[model samples]
Target: MASGMFDTPIVGVVNNLFGGLIDAPVVGRLVRRGLIKIRYVGRRSGKTIQTPVGYRRSGDGVVIHVMSPDSKTWWRNFLGEGGPITLLNFDGADRTGHAIASRDEKGRVKVAVQLG
Candidate 1:
C-alpha cells in the first residue's frame, strides 16, 4: 500500500507515541530499530521541529521517505538542497547533515541527507 494511505489522525497519534518512546532509554533502543527522529528548523516558523520518520542509510547519506508528501510541509524546507538537519541514529549519536527533498512522479517524497 502507498504510505499516504496511512496518513490519518490516528497514525499521527501513534507516530507521536512512538516518537516519545524513542526518546527514552531502553525503549528507545527497541523503537529505533524501525524509526528515526529527525530534528529540523521550521522554514517559516523558525522553530525547531522533531518528528519520527522511517529512514535507511545509503552510502554516506540517509534517505527518508515521506508517507504523505502533499499533506506534509517539513520536506519543503529542504527543497533548495541546502537545509541543515539532524538525524538521531540508532547508535544514539546525532548526525548533522544537509538534506534535499524531491518527489517522484507517484508523488512519493524522498529526502536525502549527506552527513557532515
Candidate 2:
C-alpha cells in the first residue's frame, strides 16, 4: 500500500470499526456528523463500489476530502467530466448527486457532490 500518513494497519482497522459503528442499527442514525458512505460505479470495472468517508456540508451540497488520495483509487472514477453518485447522508438517507473529483497542485483530492 502507499505510504500516506493514514495508510497504516491500525488506521485501516480503526476505519473499519468506525464504519461498522456508523452503519449500525439504531445507533447509526445518531451519527449525524463526520461520517458518510459514498456509492458509485467503477468507471472501468463497471461494478458498484461503496466506501465510508468523512464529509462536511458546503452551501447547498457536500464536500468529501479524499484522504491519502495517492493510495486510493475509488475517487478516480469521478475524474474528467465526473459521474453520478449516491451518498449515504448523515440524515440516514441515500441522497443522489453528481460528483466531480479534482486534485490540486498540492495533491489534495476532493470530491464535490451536488445533491439533488
Going through the candidates in the order shown, the clash numbers are: 0, 0
- Supply candidate 2's per-residue lDDT for 18: 73
lDDT of each: 0.83, 0.83
Q: Candidate 1's residue-wise lDDT over 1-116, tens digit each?
A: 22464656786798789888888777888777768998999888999998888888789988998877776677888997559999876466898999999888888889998999
- Give lDDT: candidate 2, residue 5: 57
Q: Which clashing pairs does model 1 show?
A: none
Candidate 1 wrongly placed segments (more than 4 Å): 1-12
Worst 10 residues of 1 by lDDT: 1-10
